[model samples]
Target chain A: MEKKSTEQLEAICSQVRRDILRMVHACQSGHPGASLGCTEFFVALYFDQMTNNPDFNLDGPGEDLFFLSNGHISPVWYSVLARSGYFETSELKTFRKLNSRLQGHPATEEGLPGIRIASGSLGQGLSVGIGAAFAKKINKDDKTVYVLMGDGEQQEGQIWEAALSAPHHKLDNLIATIDLNGQQIDGPTKDIINLGDLKAKWEAFGWEVIVTEHGNDMSGVVKGLEKAKSLLGKGKPVLNLLHTDMGYGVDFMVGTHKWHGVAPNDEQLENALGQLKETLGDY
Target chain B: MENKLDTKYTYTEKKDTRSGFGDGLLEAGRRNENVVALCADLIGSLKMGAFQKEFPERFFQMGISEANMIGAAAGLTIGGKIPFTGTFANFSTGRVYDQIRQSVAYSEKNVKICASHAGLTLGEDGATHQILEDIGMMKMLPNMTVINPCDYNQTKAATIAIAEHEGPVYLRFGRPKWPIFTPENQEFEIGKAWKMIEGTDVTIFATGHLVWEAVEAEAILRAEGISVELINIHTIKPLDTEAILKSVAKTGCAVSAEEHQFNGGLNDSIAQTLIRNQPAPLEFIGVDDSFGESGKPEELLEKYGLNAKNIVEAAKRAISRK
Candidate 1:
């Protein structure tokens, strides 16, 4: 797989942001805040970073796997997966609707092609990622396993349980990233429960830590992912602390937790879509 | 030979069901290389040492982190690995209910959740260690198969059998040395009831350690001129409705005995089966909505109304009601 250029990936990111706003607007419910906030990271991961096949196989041998721990942000994932040919982009309209395969949370029960595990519940994906990485090692697949989680979701004790196990078992094939968007549902993560110096915390747990301040930028995400991949196979699991806003690419929704779960109304949706270029054509 | 119930069964030896799990897991590892075991710091308690010894690379020693063990076990299925997680029943279900629900059960992952030291027979470990509500918790899950095999041989056979069974399974066993009555190396069938004795007065539906207690109750009932039909309901979730209805049709009354709580274990399964299909006179022999305490296994069973005396009394009550 050839590495996608920054220009091409950025265009895809704009389309994904548009799709997120539109999908959430259509459903009249969803977490568009984190979905928009993590656009560049998702675009970078699916389009450029992972050696994944959209022609998805449940037992993905010799391929890198990704798990969305912060699964409430399904709009972004559903859009990216659809755009990447995992499914039709038209299915984006069916998201969060009754009897739709695109559930409010990503689930394998509906036989969604890109998803391997159901992950609406937070703090579980890292462990699942570690398990998949362990399986890779056992099967001699020699591929990476990546998990993306929310900053507020770090409050869950199971995250730390997984954090301790990963390095103890020497799962260097595992790469975990926390979307340090600062804002959660109630308020800023610091105001709710301070996640004081996550980099230090991860290092103390025996993980190789990588901090990317430009998590909302395509080039920065791609670079962070590449650096994380480069540091693999060195006897430590990798943790990428990705810093972004609560909502990115839109004017009003950005930098606030108010839009964490509330959908943009029709007028607000038009304003949001106006900011994002329809580079890849709207689904 | 003089009494008919005396010829029903004979015990040559007593062995812990966890040892059967250990032996069967070792055999499962040999049969299929994809089989892997993960334990949360209870290798000896779960009897996972033999499998760990034979296939050291395949076994994962997850140091007291059961949630992570469960999550990882679910992930292992994505890569075509058959993961059997080992722990005490309390930790396996109650401790990590959310983990099992989302990662394994909801996802329909092929992970075998093998739990030991179930029910009141966990003995001196007391109320905290003993789990009575695990069957209720597990059976309620949409894609979970719940099995509580009777004796050592049956537990061993169930262990091997669940490996071939696809999707998630909760195989419950105990810590005590139980009478090995079922045939050695018998092919354990899931969701199918085992008819230990064919009779007409009352049907004794039993599971886990209480299966042995039900056997003893059958003999006593036989001597009292009451014909008791004994059935070992190993699988609890997909309750063997056909066998239950058939037995009830002949017996016209029912008694359910289990080492778990009366509300959610074998009794509930039997009651639900009977009510939906054939509503018979049912009497339950189990701990009636109460927790357990530190005591000898037999003493606890006797104290909690989980022994043959309770079963015999319950059978008589059920028969009298009819």
Candidate 2:
């Protein structure tokens, strides 16, 4: 229940990055690039930004809720949820193992404490967020809904469909963040499919667009999320474009799509862990 | 036996099953505060206007985004909201298959996917709008319950019934006006077969619009002294195996009828059930692995071999095989 400072949050982010690397390396499966990239944002939300209960109620009434649309980055989310006391941190070892609650993608079937729905399919979280936002409004709970999606996921037609309806329905209680890492599994997002003028696209879709240059920076994410939260009830859904690195903290894996899904080898994991401080003991 | 098999039941007026869904949804909203509705730009078509008007705050107009509507419906379930998504059968199942599969079915969210304009009975809208494979697609999902109610009364009861039940459900109804033979305000029991007539000759298991055809086929076969046992198998997934096996055991022959493809419709479920339990001589009356063209509802039914005559012929063929 102790409030975390910006420096404390950064240390947690580093530990989350380590958790992501170790979890993926242990499974020999999972997408680590975005998971590491969104570590700061996840830490900021769970530890600092989101007003949530660690007890983990499925409906999340009277509290801020978050959804992972680009569910491939579930390692980072699972790490943060466990670190934030949603469940025991020791459960991180079971990530992607048989009968593990932490699947490759976030799912609720295992009765995971934090996940509200199964998500790995792209472009679905925003819609689910909008629904939760609407539900909050109906229940007279003034809580906000946060969703994280991949830049590559914007190509999915359903994302645009959700984009058009969120603002139309005046879902100001909803705030969506896109990890603009500029890299996807195939290659660079521009080469795969350029998302020209993301800010313009969101503006045209009637959302209040906030473009942040430093998504990997803990202070920047905390600031951007605070600003997005401040803009609530303004009759516009907020869209935050967080510019981040694909393989953020790991030196060898950074700045490329090569590590988008591949797990780090034993030596590579040791090197990655060396860069990411184990401020909070490793799971 | 309680509902009098020998007495013939008929309706003076005909109504589309979709209207029953609309009425049932409105009633459900009235009954439960948690019942909510979502539509993918097909409110009028899905007969959801009444629900929308009555409960505008709870009703979500999701535009033409069937995929988003489905995911949102799944999300709504997290808050104990029983969301009923409305759209055409094609958009409901085929268009958003992965969305429903991942977000709703796999997540085990309590969602009701109310699909209208199902099967060839969708009339002149043609094959693109008329979804004949939705029942199969939905039934295959692990946590999905598939229901294809025959008439307005049955569809209404089924709609209201699904709202009370937990987990995901696919309620498939048609756009065309059909006979309303089932009782009004009847309690619809999920996965239970409705036996309209009991006979010794053959068991005619039908669903959706084809149930009416089976009724007519029963009347014709009864005149010819065939003595048919006409059973309405509304819930396709939890196939009333006991009812099917019991009826087929008594008759020694079966005819499965539906307004869907013969490959993966009610017939396929009945076949799987019979193959496992009481193996009986079976014939299928459905679209013979072909897409339907633009035509009247009645014409399309006749052309696709989903009429009373087709059921009668299938019954005779099954009896002969037996």
Candidate 3:
């Protein structure tokens, strides 16, 4: 398949944002804040950065694998996975519904094509990524492993344990991206639990840290991911600190912790959809 | 009744169940290329040195991070690698429960959670290190296979057997150097109880180090003309319900024993089975709603009412009640 142009990728990101808003709006109980926040990162990874096939395999051999650590943001992943031919685009309608493969959080028991592990519990995906990266090394596959976590999830002690492990094992084939949106449920992350100088923290933990100022911008995400990929195999894991608004793109929801998990009302949905534009058609 | 009990079961030497795990893990690593091992900084304690030495590439040393070890083990299964995580029973279950629940069991990943130093026999470590509720905690999880092998030989066979079976398994063993009575190369079937002795008076359902105590209790009861049947319940979940019912049907009374607490251990499971199928007089020979203190393994077992004398007393009580 030919590489998708920047404009085409931007169109996909816009559609994913629209899907996130609609899925959460339909359920009336889902996390749209981080889902909307990480729209460009997901689009950029799936559409451009990662080497993957639409023909999904559980054991992702000879391909770059991605794990959603902060799984509350499942809408964006569901949308990107569906839109990228992992499954039918219409399946996005079943988000969080009973008996639907699209669970509230990404799960493998439902046999969803894209998900390999059930991840709603924060601070587990990094260790999982390390294991997959270790598997790649064992198989000599030479492909990379990518994982995304939320900024609030850094408060979990297990994340710090994994933070030490990845570098100790010299997991150079792994790239971890944190959505530094500075917001979590109940309040702002700094108010709930301050993660002081994240870049310095990751650096202290021995990861090659890279920060992207414009996480919502498609071009910025693509470039930042490219830079992360370039720093691979340098005997250290890469941590990309992506600066993003908690509830980006939507006028009312943006820059607040209230919408972290609360779904928008009907009127709010219409308002958010009006801003996002149905570029690739709504699911 | 067709009795499969080994009447002449005996051992000249004793060995810790953890060594059996280490040896069996080495054999498993040799048999399957996909077999991989991970430890949370208890290399010497978990007895993974041989497997690590042989398959250096397959072994991962996850330093003092039980949760990360569990999560990584789940992740390794994504790439079709059978990961066996080793640590103390307390850390394996109580410490990293959410990790195992979400990543491994919930997803039905084929990961082996090999836990050593289980129960009050993790002697001298006190209640904090000794996990008397691990069996209950693990057996409660959906899609989880719980196995608590009795002796060194049985633990070895179980360690190798679980590697062949699919899905998540919690293989619980102890730290004490118990008598090695089970056959060296016996077929260790998951969820199947082994009859160590046969009688019609009372059935003693025992697990882990307590199985040997049950055997001793059988001899003591038999000498007093009170026939006792001993059944070794290795696997706690997907329990051998048929065997239990059949044994209890003949014996008319039952006694359950383990190195764990009575609340959620072998007795609780047996009580459930008996109540559901054939309610009978049952007595428990285990810690009674109490934590264990630091002592020699033998002294602790005796003090906590997990000894052969306690099993014999419970057997008498159960028979009298019947």
Candidate 4:
């Protein structure tokens, strides 16, 4: 697949951010801060980097796998899944309501097409990813495995356990991304629990580490991802620390913990939607 | 480190069921390439050392990470591999339940959750370590196959049988050694109960270590002119309802014994079976809804009413109800 230009990738991410705000607003209750924050990175993955068969059946024998360890941001994942043709874009309105396949957290219990495993209780997806990657290696398949974790979720001891296990197995085909968005539901991550020196910590576990600040810039993310993909199949695991502002596009929600879990009321919705273009039209 | 199972189930010295689990795991490594073992520490106790030594590549020491080990085992199963994960019963079921629920049972992964030191047999480990609820906890999984083999031969056979089957299985065993009476190379069948002895007076349904106690109790009862039928229920989930119903029909009374709690454990399954199909006068012999303290295995058994004496008393009580 040919790479998209920086401007085009940014345009797509802009559209995704717009979808996140509108989808959460329509539901009247959902997590939009992390969704809004991780748009560009996911957009780059879906449009530029991830080797996913969009028409995903749960068990893709030779296909690559991407696990959203921080599963509360289901809005962004669902939008990306729909936009990438895992299902119809029309199904986006069933975000959190009854009978909707799109649940509050990513779930396979509802039989959503793209999901392989259910994840909401945090700090365990890396182990799942490593297992998948290990299986692929055993089968001699060349597909890569990717997992994303929230910065706040780094407090979970299981995350480090999975992290240590990943590199110990020389899981060079697995790459984990940490969404270093400085806020969680309770408040800023620093106040709840400070996960100091994440790079040093990951490196200490024998992972080849990379840091990126271009969470909103598609070209930079795509480039970093390319380097990440190139480094795979080596003897060391890769850990990419992605720094991004929470609520990146919506000015009102940006940089504040209030927008993390609080649903935007009618007036607030209008203010938030004013900044984002209706690229693919609101659900 | 201990090679007690090298003989054909005829060892003089007694050993814990944890050692049996380790023995079976070590043998599984030599027999099949697809047989990979994962453990969250406790390698020596689980008796997985030989498997680790023989096929060092296939064994994964998952540290003290029970959740990750379960998830990884689930992932391993996706690639047509038989993964035997060893850990204490408490951590294997409750600590990482969500992980096992999502990654394994829900996904229908063919992983063997081999739990060691199950029930009150973990003795001095106290109530915290004595997971008498593992049988109930594991059977609750929709796709999980729960097995509690009686002794050395049955546990080893069940461990081998799980590899041939293609789904999730929870193999629960204990930390005490009473007797090894099951036949050698009998080809353990999943979900089928074995009738150790046949009689007309009463049926004593037992699993894990109690199978031996039930046998001993049957011998004593026979001397007293009481003809007792003995049934070893190795598989708890997909409970052997056919065998249970047939035996209860002939005897008209039944006794259910296990090293677990009576309410949600093996007794409940037997009660539910009888209530549905073959209702009989029933009395359960087990840890009656209470926590167990750390003690010698024999003392704990006597104190908790999970021994041969309790089985005999329950048999008499059940027959009187009839």
Candidate 5:
């Protein structure tokens, strides 16, 4: 895979954001807000930060791995994975369709190239990442494991359970980032359940914490991820508190939880796509 | 179909099935370096101490969080590691059903969910600890193979055997120091039922702790001139329907026994097999839609109608109905 400049990565982010809106609008029932907001982070990881194989091996023997905890944002991941060459970009049109490799949630049952485990029921991905990291350590694979989780998903007790176990195992090879978009399906996360001081909470759990305010910015996310990589083999797992907006880029949908699950209507789809440039062309 | 009682079943000692799991897990770790063990703070109870001591790097102490253990086990499979998760039946199935369903079974990950202290025989820990409905919960999952080995020897074979077999498996065993009747070196088959005795009067399909009870009932019935054929239906999910149908065809009557709920356990499996293939008179011997309380395992078995006496009565009732 050829290395891309920050400008090229930003271009891919725009195309991914466009793909998210188009895929959601095509299905008429998929998540676009969080997918839109997490575009830059996904772009940065796949395009610039991580050394992964798009050839797609289940075991991922010598390559870095990523697990999506917040499966609702499959649009952004599918787009990024397809754009990054895991599968054909044209296959992205089959999102949530019958007999499609891209299921409503990321699943391995269909034998999807990039997916190693099924994760729709929240708070399990962190543990999975830790397990993968453990496998890497046992096999003497020096590659890292990354997990992306939703902020509202923090309400799940299993997340805390995983949060405690990762550091206890001293999985310094694992890096977890939370999409602190401050919005959930119900409303704002503050209204439903307050996750007070996640940084302090992670620190209290004995993790090396790194907070990045510009989660939607390609350069900032890339820097934060690189810093996280530098902290590995330092005897502690790292947590990146990525502060992203729920519905970013699009003017009307920005900063609202309304688009959390609801797909963009015909007019809204046009309006949303207009904001994100067609840098890599429509799938 | 003849009753192939290959050897006279006998045991001079009583051992807990959990030990078989412990020893088998240790052996499995030795056989396959990919075989790793994870325990959610039940290292002693699940008898994972030996494996932990031997393969320190392979054993993961996942604290008291069963859900995390299950999820982690699923993920371990992606890196070519076969993880065997250990915990109580209650936590292994019911507490982490979602985790097992999505992460392990649904995803088709090769995870051995080795659960100890299953059913009413979990004893004084009471109803909260004993999980009678675990079989039903796991059996309903798409890719889960539910196994309830009757004794120590069988449980040990199962623990080692599941590592060789791919996909997710739910290996159910008990805590009590029960009679060890099965052969020590028996090759544990995942979905094949074992024939303990051959008879014509009735067929007794038993699993987990109740296989020994069926054996004792065979003796009592044999004295009364009633020939009884006992079959151990170890693997409940991919049920050995052919063996069940063949045996029931010869016997004409059947008694289903288990240390689980009468509704979902071996009773349901046998009843379904019989009703679907060869419908026959079947009597159920299990906890009759009730929860177990604080008591010794023997006392609890007798009180809950899971003993030889109950089996005798049920067998007689099943035979009389024919």
Candidate 6:
């Protein structure tokens, strides 16, 4: 809907990646792989697609709402929300620490402006998105609702239950995006639990499914999101399957599942940061 | 003692707690503009047909997805709207345990998880549907308010009461057309026990459909020259500690009954309450750790030791201990 230069967006995303590393390293605990993999998507979604007025505070009266189903990737979401004016970027230091608003999982209890509910346990964001979409429709608002889920998290039966019902209820205003990284906690996705034909599975559930080759590719992300927006209000929900690299910018962390929840120690951190250019100022 | 808590209250022949929840939800929709209902495939079983038919726009038939239903309920609470999600007790708690733990309970959303067909009374469906551990599962959550009402009127009242209260709550009831003994207009209050009869020898704490059997046991005991105090422990999480301690102080012994396993039903709560506050000699009336099977409701009730005779026997034993 709104176009910001790719250079600026890319700069912002690089800062987000730094924040993700710092946030995790500071806490000495947290998920950084998926956060690094999905940083560009969050940056694109927050800076480009969503119309959330963090400055306005519509009382959630008539604002766009986003739910993070895969809440373990809180580092990227917290960074993006802060950089987008939801809060100060300095708040990134408090992530996953005691008495911090940024918890390991996203929750509304901290009175955070962007997060509507607590989510870390997976396979629940779509239903929460559907409920918020229904509320928005009931309140006569044209704003849309969005949610992000992990590809492996689709194994949760509740996600499909919500998937089948969203189209049945014709929640066309809701759009769900999946980070299809093809890896989970144990090993490769197939080794852990093969999710056969995810695109066909969603299509079978009667959703308008879209696919992107690179989740971090800004131009592709913008194009895919724009196409998803055009399909809205067509009497069906939208699903975007973004094919993302496991560690996106970091060469070593890419294409593996071992780094899913582990925080990089001092040596690994230096190696990872070496591969990723500090294009933007570090947190 | 025979005239204890006269049953002159007018109620329909008998009705499942699901119907009461449905009725209460319809009333809530009419009373509050922000009340919305979401169902996960078991709409017909949950008695949400009336709500869907009346408010097609407001009722969201969420197919067979319990995960999304929980998340959506949390999202609906973002702007001060109250969302009620309905489904079987098994799927409502066990199937989507993490969803509820994170999205709804930990987040502290004002969503009502209305679970029907709890305990062994979910007959014919057998062990898969009979979820006795749901009380313990839901109560363990930090911000969740666990309530298991006795019958149709009480369940309906609880449904209405939860919509008014602003927080996450789990309202548990059952399938069978239980004896609707409570007054029609009884105002349901959370964390308060309903004293059906006054006695000083022993106290009987009951919840859900077992409340009827407990009352019957009280009548049977009265006939056999025993004065038994009957207390309906509808809300389990907020266990009515004051009422339980006060009753146990006078009657230094207690009996707990429910249509669930002895592990995590009303008995465990009563035991914990007494252990924490006032220690009392207690007897438990429930099924042991065993799975249910396909059978008639009354036949299963008798076989599982959840009938009036079990409560009466437990009361006699409790009195002996005192």
lDDT tens string, model 5, A1-283?
A: 7888999999998899889988888989999899999999999988888889999999999999999999989999999999999999999999999899999999987788888899888989998898899999999999999999999999999999999999898899999999999999999999999999999999999999999998988889999999999999998999999999888899998899998999988998887888888998898
- For candidate 2, chain B by itself scores a TM value of 0.97
lDDT of candidate 2 over A1-283, digit per residue (tens):
6888889998898889888999999999999998889999999888888899989899999899999999999999999999999899999999999999999899888798998888998989988898888889889999889999999999999999899989889999999999999998899999999999999989998999998889988888888998988888999999999999989998999899999999999999998898988999998
Proportion of true inter-chain contacts also present in candidate 4? 0.53
Question: Which of 1 and 6 is the better model by DockQ?
Answer: 1
Residue-wise C-alpha lDDT for candidate 4, range B173-241, written one tens digit per residue: 877775666775668999999888889999999999888778778876887888899998999988999
Q: Compute the lDDT for candidate 2.
A: 0.90
lDDT of 2 by residue, B172-268 (tens): 9989988888899998999999898989999999999888888888877887889999999999988889898989889999999998888888989
- Model 2 residue runs over 4 Å out of place are B1-7
Clashes of each: 0, 0, 0, 2, 0, 6
Report the C-alpha displacement of residue B224, candidate 4, in angstroms: 2.3
The Cα error of candidate 3 at residue B223, in Å, is: 0.7
Each model's lDDT:
0.92, 0.90, 0.91, 0.83, 0.91, 0.84
lDDT per residue as tens, model 4, A70-154:
8888889999888877988889888889999888888776689888777777876788787777777777878888888999899
**Residue runs of model 4 more than 4 Å from their true location after superposition:** A57-59, A281-283, B1-32, B124-128, B276-279
What TM-score would you give candidate 2 relative to the actual structure? 0.98
How does residue B260 of candidate 4 score in lDDT?
A: 88
For model 3, residues A107-132, the per-residue Cα lDDT tens digits are 99879999989999889999888888
Every prediction: chain A TM-score: 0.99, 0.99, 0.98, 0.96, 0.99, 0.95
* Evaluation by DockQ, superior candidate among 2 and 3: 3
Error of 5 at A109 (Å): 0.8
CAPRI verdict on model 3? high
Q: Looking at candidate 2, what is the lDDT of residue A237?
A: 94
Candidate 1 lDDT, tens digit per residue, A1-283? Answer: 6777899999999999999999999989989999999999999999888999999998999899999998999899999999999999999999899999999999998899999999989889998998898899999998999999999999999999999999999999999999999998889999999999999999999999999998988888988999999999999999999999878999898899999999999899999999999998998
Model 1, residue pairs in steric clash: none
Q: Model 2 residue B302 lDDT?
A: 81
Worst-scoring 10-residue span by lDDT in model 4 chain B = B1-10
Order the candidates by lDDT, highest first: 1, 3, 5, 2, 6, 4
